[model samples]
Target: MIKSTDIIRCCASPHGIFWLTVAVLAIPNVALCFTERMGIMASVTNIVLPVAAVWLLMALGRRPGKTALLLFPLMFLAAFQIVLLYLFGHSIIAVDMFLNLVTTNVGEAMELLDNLLPAIVIVVVIYVPVIVLAVVSLRRGDVLSRSFLLRQRRRSLAALVAGAACMAGSYLAGRDYSARLHLYPLNVFYNIYLAADRYKATADYPQTSAGFSFNAVPTHAASGREVYVLVIGETARACSFGLYGYGRNTTPMLQRTGGLTVFSDAITQSNTTHKSVPMLLSAASAEDYGRIYREKGIITAFREAGFHTTFISNQRPNHSFIDIFGKEADDWKFIKEETERSDMYDEDMLRMVNDILDKKRAKELIVLHTYGSHFNYRERYRRSEAVFRPDNASEAKVSNRRQLLNAYDNSIRSTDRFLSLLIRQLDRSGAVSAMLYTSDHGENIFDDGRRLFLHASPIPSYYELHVPLLIWMSPSYRQMYAAEAAAVGSNSRKSVATSASVFHTMLSLAGISTPLRADSLSVASSSYKPGERHYLNDHNLPVAIKKILRGDEDFVMFRKMNLKY
Candidate 1:
């Protein structure tokens, strides 16, 4: 056997050093591809990128400093693999995930670190050796003779040609596999470049109002003081709610409560709050996101309709949507100051509501944004309030699935209680009030055979899209607008509904009409049609949840049941 020192000396040779540098830069990409179960051809396609980059860089100029620069990207590539392997249970990092990370704020980052500290530690431990080896190899350099340089250049040129051929062949042979290479860390540099451009674009985006008013008219004559309360819930799935046929009585208060209409088929606009909330509030489909962002939302429309608008949030302040529309509210209050810690509860928002509605104005539009049932579900409600016991799996980071389910159910119970309290307050106030409650999106708890465990997966599933939607109209309010109330109750059981319908429904509930409103699709419209259930995201492609849930054939069959209106 060769001695360790001899092996080191041999690898320190000019040719050995050059090849070692190439291996160091390329191994991370190769390892990631292999771990991801990429086919040989697909692996070759990914391996070619960084290898070609290093070969080209070295072939053009064999400088130590220049070659050392390649290590930075290699380190990033390795780090990405390690972190992804732990967090997502795979080593594939997509463009959207990268963008989410790039745009994440400091507070969000801290929260992430708190949850993922173990994963971070594992990443550091695993990549430290590779980093040290790269550094050591960079420090030791051997100058090649003229003839050797020429020979190496010829070989590298040949290798470059072969790599290019492999890439083309992989694409031709396995298009889908090759396409997925965009998720590999070999594209990290490109993704970072794109992210920087996106950051600048978002920053340069105008903070001022979209200015154009819909100037909608109320179809019905005004009655007593109109109190429309819009509750934006967070991460509560429909399937888990008792009101939506959940096995557990997670919504006891809602079940017993009168004048509360639950829409069975209510789905979210998107899986993410950042996308769903903004799009829904603005009456913007994913197709026309930019245009809607440039224009005012329903808050502005209510304001234009001469309603006293108040935005009370238990969520973090200065969110993108909150910044735009919430700012436009006549009275805006956020009870939860710090997002990292859970100090304020959803019940605290009720206090803010009491303060705002102490004396009601002519027409009051109160938007309550709650941090209901977000991740770490047990923390969302007090331990004493937990109806489902042995709920330590999520808190202890164990895989006791029953415990996880229990914790989730407990959070829903808390939400039910909070909603009950709000309803009681509204009833006691004796104002003509109506409250609309719908989550920003749903959560996944390994329900399907796929074993998906979170919201925001690249793959679309019914669990992440279906959410609980309910409207509570006080006796006084229902009596004031009997026809409108009947219309809302009639459409509550519609087989298909989406968060996009919220805008038009809100307008209808408020008796405010705008040319922009699609009354046919509104739940509060007598001519209610489910329409096509298309889920939107930041991605260009519109996800048809209807098709995903009830296959293409069934979706077609179901749509036939509803009239086009």
Candidate 2:
């Protein structure tokens, strides 16, 4: 028979109590994960929550047992599910936020549940054990009685402090490295979480001076011109396009067209479209956006200038930051292809654009925002019929990754085909149609070894910033604005531009004037300089771009960031 003390030691071990504490403490950390971006399940979330729970209970003198250990798996599973909710919660919340806005929860849970399986599996695998232990601990309450545990564990106080430090330190490090650029110190964890957004928005503030802010362009010209079309692309970083020196034939038609002004060195001020689009049209840098006056965004400027401005986007109107641009557009239409609801190609948007062009009967500015090259690549593209498979499987037996990429490229090709038609239509209309095409950002395009596609920080390399910007002025408009054409084509040093200059450039093209317009950005203005480009990351930090512009020998060899605007 086993000795009585040996049996007692087994019953009094701390593992059981520790696991139970974790299950309880996990509730809050899982909740915070949802506030970031949609669709993520970081492994870091797995360890921290439970450890904190154990730390809290052990700090008060609790000894664990077989029952508590048994509870571990079950709680672990539940915690996993909660992390899934945290990651894709925004997408799921689409139904919830929408339902609550309209008061309908009929399909809320089910819809979120469908996309949640991957995250769910990951969570259940991690948490199931802890959950089982929590239940077992509650049932065998007598053996693990609270008062007896407190008295027995009184001498373990030093170990408790050490364990708590480990737990707290892990959470702090994970929060900083995993989310905030690995930038903040440990003590600043709470402060970092609290002030993340304020920092991103603060970028626009530094650009503002005294009485000025972002550019304020009137929608209509004093001359009362016709229509202007702004085609805003998605995830189309310039680093990949052949026109910008990539080996691919991404923009042949754009290159063939003589009137298109390709900005070889244009940089986006923000990493994600959510931040970039607002900064672009809002007429401010990420640093100086809202110093004093809340200047209107692109469409807002057009509206204020007396034009009926509208926005047609393939991106979900409610997808996180789409609202940043969507809210300012006088008319907003979000076309999500995944719904299988709309019967339109990119060109079909032309019908709507044409309708507005006719209905307005005066000058107009139209913005067509695309959902091009977004991941879930297969869904974005047409069925691939191309013979060249990257992985050498020309047949249909290819992996999901290969097929997904092929599908994505096909989608880009389809967009190109649509653009060709759009340009032809604009040319045939007999009215001046000035078209400017630029993506909010670019895609990864399988450049990095990372399996999944991502646009924001951590993986934000040059591929995300170098985007194709093709501006084409209709023949009549070109004739009228020949000096602008010469300025754009000139090899002079002053033509350089950051995405911030796009607002001023468009305003100048449309004969609209804005206070923030620099001479280089305005064809109407004679003042110009060369060799200046400012690029910003998701955080709106200038360090990366500044290095490239300072004639860093590495960038100089590649002729990278020094492009004329």
Candidate 3:
């Protein structure tokens, strides 16, 4: 009566069913984990990926009912992600930095481990739903049979062994590669996948020194202007300017100016904000800035010139750049209001600057950093009462890209309006006023490809890397610095000047004697100088390949056509 075949089949069936249930439950829990951390939603359309992946695995010799049944949800999530990319991928870029993860490395991770019990407590708070799902699955008894377990035991053990091998192989990788494992998401793989990418980029992107002393530093010691205010704008690309030949009239007020020296070809030292802002404010080129920034930065040069230094910003402060300058500055101010309130705009920052200018000395070095055109583009724009564009426009007209650019341009336009206000106020104050404006880096909208979004994702395109460098001198400063101003044409012919030159330029304009970087400093005493002020490379060049990485297919299009820079 003990029919062995029938009994075996029934048991195997229950085991398979239960195993599949647990697997299904596990995926959503993990996916929810990622989603909670990241905030992505799911839909039926998203299901195809997991299904296909299951089938593909089956085809690659897994089980049809079991393999797919287990892998389906995650497959769906990843698939949906790819599909979403296919649909709206036009404006997303993924990026990571080695310095960020590596600098404090083991110390931080160890501290996290030191707090492991607390972290586990936090995980418990988050894992409630997963626990519920597991409990629900447990209520339903064995869904797999003995035979099925016997069959899968060998495959499962082999898979576990292979996975262990991969994990060990990755962890055993180099420390630099290993450091990245401490980062979010990428750490799940223990930095195995992203480590290679970091290595390749680091090796390819060796830093260069800033010409702070006799070379790249530009000297500007004229007395016509009582004060010069260099407003270093952040992440603004030059080509988007109507003044710079963009069809969009993005810089209407700026272009109307008679005295502004807008360099059409200036570029940032790097595409990412981390790389660019520090270089602009310090004496290091893209090549060497990272190393030297850990040392004394541009503020020392500015301060030595007898100018009071004040850094005001809304962006998150990082260790190796303009942010560090603030910590080193005589006065450093940051407002949480910028990050918290949606209604709070750059104008609020201007008001703060105005207030500071109102109460104290009239001619201090006030640096204002704006979070212009940063991501979540929708959030950046002021709430519109109504549509600015007519109904005839589709995405090409009212596209998210254009909308973000509009928000950024509107902010710039506001900056222009404010500058006009400040100039009038400064003129009344009897102090020279000159404003130098530049961005940390430019943004990459849907311009380049489906692969990346924002500035500094890959090698970084000039669009995202190149920024706007606008200089407005008060009448007095202009008159005093006349010879310096007259040296460059109203239409100043360009040089391949990077942030390394900016350090010297800032000093030269202020008539400061201190060097930012001995190698990158240059004086623009006369504007006709055409030379490589300071260039950048991701890495040391092999003798066989002296090729420059500046004009890759992605960056070449941005070089000639006028950008906001």
Candidate 4:
């Protein structure tokens, strides 16, 4: 048997260090084979091309130390890839994922990282040593032997030729394969470029949309008193709500509440909050997301229609379109900015709503953006709301799924209570009123064999896209608009895209007439029609759900729920 000392010496050698660096760099590429869906040729080329490129660089450089150091940037990419793989299970680094790094606040980041200890540990163990080795090798002036370098260079050239051939073969065989799209570092770099481009566009939004208008007008008499509230929930999955046939009584209050219509088959166009929320608030859909940069949101439409629009949000501003659109309201306040407290709950937003209602404007439109059922789920609700016991999961691990789910269910219960109370307040207002509630997107809670556990993955799972959409109309409003109320109930089981439907439906419910509104997309309209669903991809392009959804499991789930994919 070889001694431990012998193994150490071999590892300490320049060749060993060079190979180690290549292997470490190849981790993400190798991982893509298992995590991503690709055919045999595409998978083989993905691994071979990237590895060959690394080998070529090392051999061509002659000095293994400097070459490894030159490739050090990839170490960071590898760490990011591994962590994402641990969290999402598939797909390359997306533009939104990159943007989220900048937009995610310290509190939110810590909450996510707190549960990602295992993945973080794995990243640290795999990368830290290789990084140290690269530094040490560089300082020691380590060089590859001339003979070894020549051999490696020849092998790398052959591998590159084979890889190129396989890539071409994959395309010829009708598979979609490209090095920049399928390969690791190349795809990651392209996404970085995309993220930067999007950031620049976001910075320029004010100027781009400065002169845009909804040209809105009221269909009802301007003298009539109206109160409409749009509640945008965060990370609330329909599968966890009692109103949507969940096993638990998470939404007991909502279930019992009269005149409430639950859109059981609602799905979001985008999974990330920044994209999804903007879509919900604006006329922008997966088919026309680019229009967001050149148009104002639904708040502006309401304001133009002679309603006193107010935006009250429990979430902290992330300097995205959400902030821009919220600020467009006649009156707006971000609760977190005023409170400066981490434990601020959704109920705080209710107080703001009460304050606005007290003003008793002739026509009012209030948007409540609640911090609903986000991670650290237990904190979303009060202790009294924790009807589901043993919900104190310290870490976000699959092993602690029961506790995590319990906490999530409790938060949903709290939401149920919050909505019920809001409805009661509306009933008491004695104005022609309606409330529309839907989430920006749903959450994944280690739900299945895939083990996905969050929103905003590059590719969304069934849970992440499926959300709960509810509408509550006051008795007076329902009696006044009987046809609209009946239409809402009729469309309850329809395949609805909240991003498109919410904007049109809200206007319909409020009796607003805007040229931008489409009757077919409005759930409240008698002309409502359920169309083919689409997803807003990373590049801001609309892709049919059937074309984008990959896994058989996701298709099965969509079919099982009778939802169009």
lDDT of 4 by residue, 346-462 (tens): 887777788778888999999999999999898898887789989998475799899999999999998899999999888888889999999999998898888888888878888
Q: Write one digit per residue (lDDT tens) for candidate 1, span 104-208.
A: 456545654665566677767655644454456556643456676676677777776877777777767755644434434535555556556655544544653
The TM-scores of all predictions, comma-separated, are 0.83, 0.67, 0.61, 0.96
The runs of at least 3 residues in candidate 3 whose Cα sits more than 4 Å from the true structure, single-residue gaps closed, are 1-226, 316-322, 337-341, 356-363, 376-409, 448-452, 487-491, 515-556, 559-565
Clashes of each: 0, 54, 70, 1
Reference-based lDDT, residue 505, model 1: 82
359-446 in candidate 3: lDDT tens per residue?
5563367777776655433333355511223212112212555554555555555555555565555556566666667776677656
lDDT of 2 by residue, 430-537 (tens): 767688777777654444333223444422345566666777778887787777666666622334344566676677767665565566554333444544455553
Candidate 1 is scored at a TM of: 0.83
How far is 290's C-alpha from truth in model 3 (Å)? 3.3
**Top candidate, metric TM-score:** 4
Error of 1 at 171 (Å): 5.0
| Residues forming the 10-long window of minimal summed lDDT in candidate 1 | 556-565
The stretch of ten residues in a row with the least summed lDDT in candidate 4 is 7-16
What order do candidates take by TM-score, descending? Answer: 4, 1, 2, 3
Q: What's the lDDT for all of these models?
A: 0.69, 0.52, 0.49, 0.88
